[model samples]
Each structure stands twice: as C-alpha cells, then as structure tokens.
Target: MKTPATPPNEAERLLSLRQSGLLEFDNRQPYDRLTRLAKRLFNVSVAMVNLIDERTQIAKSVDGAVPAVLPRSVSFCGHTILQPEPLVVNDARDDSRFVDNPLVAHENGVRFYAGIPLRLPDGAVVGSFCVVDQTPRDFSAQDLAALSDLAALAEDEFAASCAATTDELTGLINRRGFNQFAAFALSGARRRAEPLTLAWMDLDRFKQINDRFGHSEGDEALKAMANLLRSAFRETDLLVRYGGDEFAVLFADTDEQGAWIAMQYLTEQVAKFNQTGSHPWTLTFSWGICEFDHHHGDLEQWLKEADRKMFSMKQKNSAAR
Candidate 1:
C-alpha cells in the first residue's frame, strides 16, 4: 500500500485548521446532525465529519461504527485533503494505493469511499465530510453533487459555530462557546476516567490599565494575554475569554500537579514578556485552578471552587503588596 505524502503547504493548512479553534472542543450537535443526514441520504454504512490533525484524522462527528480516529498514514481522508475535489474510491481492492491497506483487507473492508473536502473559510482543506460502505459501488454525477452539497453544509456549520463561539476582540473562545464546549469536554473526561483541570483567571489591575491607557490599549493587553495563553497551553486545552478582563482555561486529562506546572509556565512567559518592554504597561494575572474529581459534583460547583481559590490567591498577593 502506498501512503499518501503530506501536502507541500501542510504548515499553512494546519495553521488555518488551528485558527478555527474547533480542535479543542468535542463532537458538536451541528456536525453530528449533518453526518446523520448524510448517512441516510447516501445510504452508506458510515458518514463522518473528520478533521486531519498532524498525525491523525479525528472523526469529529460520525453516524456509524467507525473509530473516531485513524492514523494519518492510512487515512483515506488524508489523501482527500490534498485537493479541493472529492475523492471517490469505488473499490479499494482494485486501487493499488489501498489494495493491501489494512482497512481494505479487514473483514469489514471499505470497498466504497466518497470523501468531499471540508474547507475552512480561507479555502484550506482541513478534512472531509465522508461516506463509506463495505460494498463496491459506482457513483453517479448526481451522487457526487449531493455529496458536495452536504460538504458545503458542513462548512457552513463550521463557520456558524466559530462565529457564535469566538471572541471578536481576542479570537479566543467566548463565554457562550466555552460553556457549550466545556460541557462536552467534561463528559468525555469523565468517561475516560481522567482528571480534568479548570482554571479561572483575571487580569490584575486591568481596570487601571483601561482607565489609564484608554480602551484601545486595554484591548491590546487582552490580546497579548490571549496570545500568551495560546502559546503556553496545549492546543487541546480550551482557552476562553470568559468575560471582560476575565479568562478561563480547561486542561483536559490533567491533574492538580499538571495544572500547577502549567500555571508556572504561564508565569514565566509573562515575566519574559515584561522583560521585553514592548508594552507600555506590564501584564500580570491572578489564576485559580481546580482539578475536577468525581466528587466535584457538576461544572457549576467546579467553577465556583476555582473562582474562590483564585480570589483567595488574589487576596494574598494584595496583602503582599
């Protein structure tokens, strides 16, 4: 089996995909609903919305029995993203590229495949809205047209999801988006029996910065902090502009020690930023982290605890001042 080569502009493609901020979140209702519709309309055993990460293809939404992930080396979607056009493999066994592929050789082999590229707003093909079947079949022009239409619908859903959840000023996840996505993140963590950490952060003396430097400078400060957080944390973590001067980070599958280490890393990054003397004012923040145990009850309770811890730390810092 011949593995597909990476795209020449893979760096830009991955960058655009990351900019969408969809990778940090879980299976959303919009994508799932569309996949379900595609499965029914195409009469396929599997319909999925996939996102191609550097090493894996994540099935962000699926309406069939396929695994949620597959290695990039063997992923049909990987080859599909190389071009703007749909990839139709009528029979994998007849194709040299996939004839000996494990997925093709398995008992539940993939004989029919149709993958329409799911492009971002910038026309970067991140993955595919694809359908698969065990039986070899031919696709008509009408089938391709219908599949393209469904893929377009998936792209529309992505744009809408981003618009609704993204912060206009900072490009971070907004409160509305965080609430929706975090719930899914927590549920997934619980199912996997992994520790999850939530941190509440507030900019120190942010109102003073705004009052002294004007709202424009204050906006820059917020953007600067958002950039720092983005760089410091794992891409999988959910970073949010929770409110004016406030932010939240959800660190999935992290324990308390891991949370502290991340906080320390952020602190070091902030110090380095201050040393640069680029900004008119130094940026500092107070943060509180709570690792969610099953005992934490619900998200509401976990948030409150984190908030309280943050305030307590803020008070101590104030006392030291």
Candidate 2:
C-alpha cells in the first residue's frame, strides 16, 4: 500500500483549513446538498466533501455509509489535495498506488475514484470533493468538468461557513459557532471519558471603557482580550466571543482544577497587559468554570451553568468595588 505525500506547503495549508472554520462547525447541510447532487450526476456509489487536517481526514458531508473520519495516510482525498487537477483512478485494482490498499482490496470496496482539490480563496488546498464507485469506470472530459463545477460550489460553501461562524472583530468563533462546535466537542469528550471544562467570562466594567475611553478603545480592549485568550489557550481548545464583552473557552481534556490553573495564567497575562499602561483603561474579567457531566444535560445546560457561575462572580466583584 502507498501513502499520500504531504504537501510542500502543509503547515500553511493546515492553517488555512483551520482559519476556514470548516472543521469547527457542524453545519454540513450546504455541503451535503452538493454531495447529493454529485452522487446523482456522476452515478457514483459514494460522494463526499472531506477536509484533511494534520492527522485526520474529516468527512464534512458524505452520501454513503462510510466512516465520518479516517486517518489522513489512508485517505484517497489526501492524495487528491496534492495537485490542482482532479485525481482520476479508473481502476484501483489495476493501479500500483492503491492495488493493495484496504479500500481497494476489500470486497465491494472502492474500485473507481475521482477527486478535485478543494481550495480556499488564498489558493491553499484544504481537502477534496470526491466521488467513489465500487466498479471500475472510465472518466470522460465531461465528467471531469461536471465534478470541477460541483467542487467550485463546495468551495463557495466553505467560505460562507467560515464567515457565518467567525466573529468579525476578534476572529474567534461566535455564539452560533459555539453551539455547533460545543455539541460535537462534548459528545467526543463523553465518548472518550475525558475531562472537559467550560469557562464563561465577561469583561469587568466593559461598558465603562466604551463610555469613558470611547468605543474605539472598547474595540481595542475587546481585541486585546481575544488576543490574550489566543495566547493562553491551546489550539485544541475552543475560544469564542459569545457577544459584546462576553467570551468563552472550552478547555478540552481539562477538569475544573485544570481550568482554574489556566485562568490563573490568563489573569497574570491580563495583569501584565495593564502594567504596560499602553491604553487608558485596564483589562479585567470575571469568569466561572464548570466541568461537564455526561449524565447531566446538553450543551445549552452546561453553558448556562458556567454562565451562572460567571455572573455570580461578577456580582461579588461589583459588590466589592
């Protein structure tokens, strides 16, 4: 069996893929529609929209009974992203590259494959839009053109998904993005029996900054808060600008004590920022942490528990002031 070679601009490609926000959100309706269309148009047994990250090939939309995720090394889409043109395998059994591949060697497995690299506007190839069949078949020029057209639509949907999920001011995921991402994150955490913590935070006296220092300064403060969160959290953690001065972080694989330690570091970062005296006002926030309970409730309830704690802290701080 042969494995796909990593792209020369692999780091940049992965960064672009992450920035596209396709992996974070669970809204696959747009991509699903495209895959459905592709399956019918090409008369293929399987059609899928996949995103290749550092280690896994994620199926954002699939029309077949294939696994939602697969290792990048074994994914045909991994090879598809290597080129600008479509990868057409007329017969995998006859091809040396995939003759011994598990997908090809198994009964009723992949015999035909056609995939187009899904590129972002910046020209980084993120993944592939592919169609697979159990029987070998020749691909015509017309077939290739149609597939390309469908892939184009998929790219458009990718851009749209990013815009919808991302906050314009801070580049963090918004509330909608949180809802989609948190659901999946929680599910995975539960299945793996890993500790997952949620931190709900609000900037202290944020409105005062806007009123006294002007809204521009308020924007700057918000951006600084976002930057602080980015610097403090891991890439695997989900950081969100819940709206206005409220922000959130899902500490993946972290319990309440672990989250508290992270928050302590964040508090120090905020203190250091204030010491710089670069701005008229200082950055301070009140936050509350809650560990997820698998048997308890859904994402909404978890969020509410965290928010309630945060609000309680904010009130105590206000009373102290």
Candidate 3:
C-alpha cells in the first residue's frame, strides 16, 4: 500500500477507518447516484464508489448486485490508486498493471477497467468511483469526460459530510459531533500535562446588529467573521459557533501567550472589518478565552472563566464608548 501524505497515526487508525466508512458511504446518498450513473454510462456489470483504507476497500455505493468491502488486491482500483491521476485500461488483460492479478486470471474475470483516482480535499489519493466489465472495451472521449463530471459531484458530497462535523457558522469545532474527538484530545493533554483550551466565544453586540441593520445584514457579518476565522487559524485548531453568536475556539499545544498572539490577530482583523464601507454603522465583538485547567475539575469551569472575561471586556468597552 502507498504511504499517506500525512503519516497515519496508527493509534487512531481504527478510529479513522470507522469514521471513513460511516462518513463516505450511505446507500441513499449521492454516492448511490454516482454508482448508478457509472453503471449506465459504462454499461458495466459492476460499478462502485469506493474508498481504500489500509486493509479493506469499501464500496461507498455499489450497483449491479454486488456487496461492499472487496479485498484490496482483488480490486483493479489498487493499481489505479498508486499515482495521482486517472487510469484507463482498455483491456485489463493487456495492461501490465493487472495482467498477473487474480481478478483477471480467476473466474471473476475483470477484463476491462477504468478509474479516476479520487483525491481528497487534503490531496490524499483515497480511492475511486470506477467501472469494471467482464469484456474488453474502449471508452470514447465523451465517456471519460462524463466520468470526470460524476467524480466531481462525488467530491462535493464528501466535502459536505466532513464539513457537517465541524461548525460552519464560527468555523469552530461543532459540539454535535466532536464529543469523541474532544475526549481523545483531552486524554492526550492530560497525559502530557500540556495546555488544552476550550474557550467559549460570544459575539458582543450581535443582537444589536440584527436589531439595527435587519437580520439578513447580520447574517452577512457573521459569515464574514467566519471566513476570517477559518483563514487565520491553524488546521489543527477547532473553531465552532456554539449557538446564535456564541463560539468556542480550541487551541491545542499552545500556552496562554501563544493563544494571545492568535487572539490579537483575530481582534486586529475584526477591527479592520469594522473600518470597511461608509455605511454609518460598524461591527465589533467581545472575545472570551481561557486555558484548560485540570485542577479546576471540568470543561465547564474553563467556559465560565472565559465567558466572564468576555463580559468584562464588553462592559468596559460600553462604559468608555
């Protein structure tokens, strides 16, 4: 098997594999549509949208009366996956890549193969949505282009599933799906006695924006902030919109001072945004942040401290302005 661009954490390998199966494949989802489309377009006996994990090749969607999770070597997809592009085999028996493979020699007889290697948004060559036929066949330019279009649709579905687990509003880690992840991060932090932050955030004067500018304008401002937050933070950090204008940013492997650097950068950007356009009204927010403390018992204490700090900032700003 080819090595992952990001080294797989073997400790988390099982967890990652389980989640991949859960996230990528749903018989009722767009993947099912792609498999059906593949079968029709190629006129193949078998077509599937698959993801290749370390040990198993899972069919996210399969058509033409086959079950999921075929062995990786039995799959022609294994060879198609090694490089970073599409692999088109007019005749699998003639192609050196699959000439000696069991899928071709045995009664299963995978004579024709074509695969467009699915690249994850992170650039990992995961697997492909491919069509395999028992008879040798060649694809026209139109067929190849149609396959490309269907793969693009599959990519969109994959991205949406991943984005669902995180917060879209504040660009933070969402609570809805992050409980297990939080437990894992917390365990590692406690073991090493490293700093782990779970700071909750609430936008100051957020309600005022809606009250003053109308709700649509308020949504635009929130989305604007969300964009900036996503751009500014490290990929490892979790940013979530807890609810309404409330948010929580978790900074891993950082001290109070390091977080302050990120926080200051965020504050500066928000200040710059406030200066844009001459609409006669501007926007700003109060932020709350705190370091995770094992001595304080649980995550709630950390949130309370962060919330208090944010409320204090808002109060001081209110008095001065």
Candidate 4:
C-alpha cells in the first residue's frame, strides 16, 4: 500500500492545525451534528470530521463507532487534504491508491468513501469531512455539491472554535469570530423578526498615541477601549476588536436609534475615564451605526456601510478641528 504523500506546506499546515487547538478540542457537539447530518443525508454507515496531524488521523467528531485515531500512513483522509476537490472512491478495493489500505482490505471495510478537505481561512488544509459506507456506491455531482456545503459549515465551526476566534490581547472576538456569530445573529434576527444594529468604532489619533507613547501604551489604550465597550454594551451584544484600532459591536434586538443611545452612554463613560486621568492620554473616538436589513445584504456589506459612515464622521470631525 502507498502512503499518502506529505503536503508541500506540511510544516505550515501542521502549525495551523496545532494552533487551531482542534486536536485537544473537547466540544464535539457542533461537529457531531454535522457528521450526523452527513450520515443521514448520504445514507452512509460512517460520517466523521477528521483532523490529520503529523503521525495520526484524529476523528474530532464521528457518527459511527469507529476508532478515534488511526495511523496517518493508512488514513484515507490523509490523501483527501492534498487536493482542492473532494476525494471520492466508489470502490476503494478497485483503486490502487487505497486497494491494499487496511481500512478497505479489512472485514466490513470502507467500500465507498467521500471526503472534502476542511480548510482554515488561511488556506491551510487541516482536516476533512467524510462519509464512509460498507458497500460501494456511485457519488453523483449532486452528492459532491451537498458534501461541499456540509464541509463549508464544518470549516465555519473550526473558524469559530475558541482557539481560533478570540483576539488574544483584548479578549474580544476577532474578525473570524465575527463571521460566525454575526451569521448566527442575522439568522436569528430573520427568524424572530427582530432588529439588529451594527456599530463601527475607531479610536481617534490612535496612531499618534502609538508614535508618542510606544506600542505598549497603544495596547493599554486598546484594552481600555475594550473594557469601556464591555461596560457600555449589554452582555448579549457582540463586541469585537476588529484589527488595530478598529472595534465593532453587534447590538442584538436593537434598532439604529437604540444603538445610538448606547453609544451616547459609551461616550459619557469615555469622558469620565479621561476626566479621572486614568491613563496618560485622553480617549476619543468616532463611530457610526447601521441597522441591518434582513432582505438586503450580507454581514460584510453591512459592515462596509457602517465603516463608510464612520469614515465620513472621522473626516468631518478632523475638518472641524
């Protein structure tokens, strides 16, 4: 039997896998649901989300009673991650690549196998979402499309995983986390017919602060901003430190006017903080709010609208000064 060839970016791929923290991930509910759906939809005997590490294939989630770990040399998933497309073997016994592989040569082995590589946003192939059957079967174009969709969802779960989602500095959700939670919030808003407002915030003269006080002080300013956001916004709201000095808040079940009122409170809190001389520099910011339209656009589009408005406000404030 031939061993799966190592990926060209094997070192980088392994680093991404380890950093993702999926190997030691304990929460398997989301993955289990996806695998279960795949098994039911495809009528497969085994459905699993498998993470391929350096020497072993770890099943993060499985719907069948299969071993949680397997030698990478003999793993079908090890080959799946090598390409950009789904790997489908109608009969592994008939394919030279997997013909002698123990998984197929054994009793009640994997006869039909279909797997789509699960990729991190950074284009690293860390694992695969696969469905296995004891009997050989044909996989149609429609089957491949369905599997791809499920695999995309699985990838989202990985991006939203704790290891990947948080901004290490401020303990706020990063952009990746925003994508996952924002999608869920939008879905919930649509279903419940509730209003959802998004706010974009930028720290005014933030670069000057870094230039004058050093990066350490800039970090402190960011932490202060994050803390202020936490104190001002409700716990239900989604707060994110969206890169450098940019921040965002998704106000659930709130309208544009309500969000504006909350911003007013945050402004007051900022003024109080400055008056207290809590830090070396005074805090100031520019912000804009947008109410999401359920029928109109996506999260990125919505974010752009708010960002455009915030930029406009920033420019106007600068001109006034």
Top candidate (TM-score): 2
State each candidate's clash count: 0, 0, 6, 0
Model 2 clashing residue pairs (backbone): none
Per-residue CA lDDT of model 2 for 1-321, tens digit only, reads 889998899999987776666675567788999999999999999999999999899999999989989999888998999988899999999999999988889998899999999988778999899999999999999999999999999999877766587887788988768878988998899899999999999999999999998988999999999999999989999999987798999999999999999999999999999999989999989999999988876777888899999999999999999
Question: What tens digits encode model 4's per-residue C-alpha lDDT throughout 1-321?
Answer: 889999999999998776565664456899999999999999999999999999999999999978999999999999999999899999999999988888889898889999999998778999999999999999999999999999999999888773467787788987667777899999999999999999999999999999999988998999999999999989999999777788999999999999999999999999999998967888899999999999987887998999999999999989999
Better of 3 and 4 by lDDT: 4
TM-score of each model, paired residue for residue: 0.56, 0.57, 0.50, 0.53
Off by over 4 Å in 3: 1-28, 166-176, 179-321
lDDT of each: 0.88, 0.90, 0.70, 0.90
**Model 2 lDDT on a 0 to 1 scale:** 0.90
lDDT tens string, model 1, 1-321? 888789999999998777576675443788888889999998999999999989999998999998998998999999999887899999999999999988899988999999998988777889899999999999999999998998899899777655578787788988768878988988888899999999899998999989999988998999999999999999989999887888999998899889999999999999999999987889989999999877546988988999999999889887888
Off by over 4 Å in 4: 1-163
Q: RMSD to the native, candidate 1?
A: 18.0
Tens digits of per-residue lDDT, candidate 3, 131-188, equal 8888999888898888888888887776665546655444445554455466777788
Q: How high a TM-score does candidate 2 get?
A: 0.57
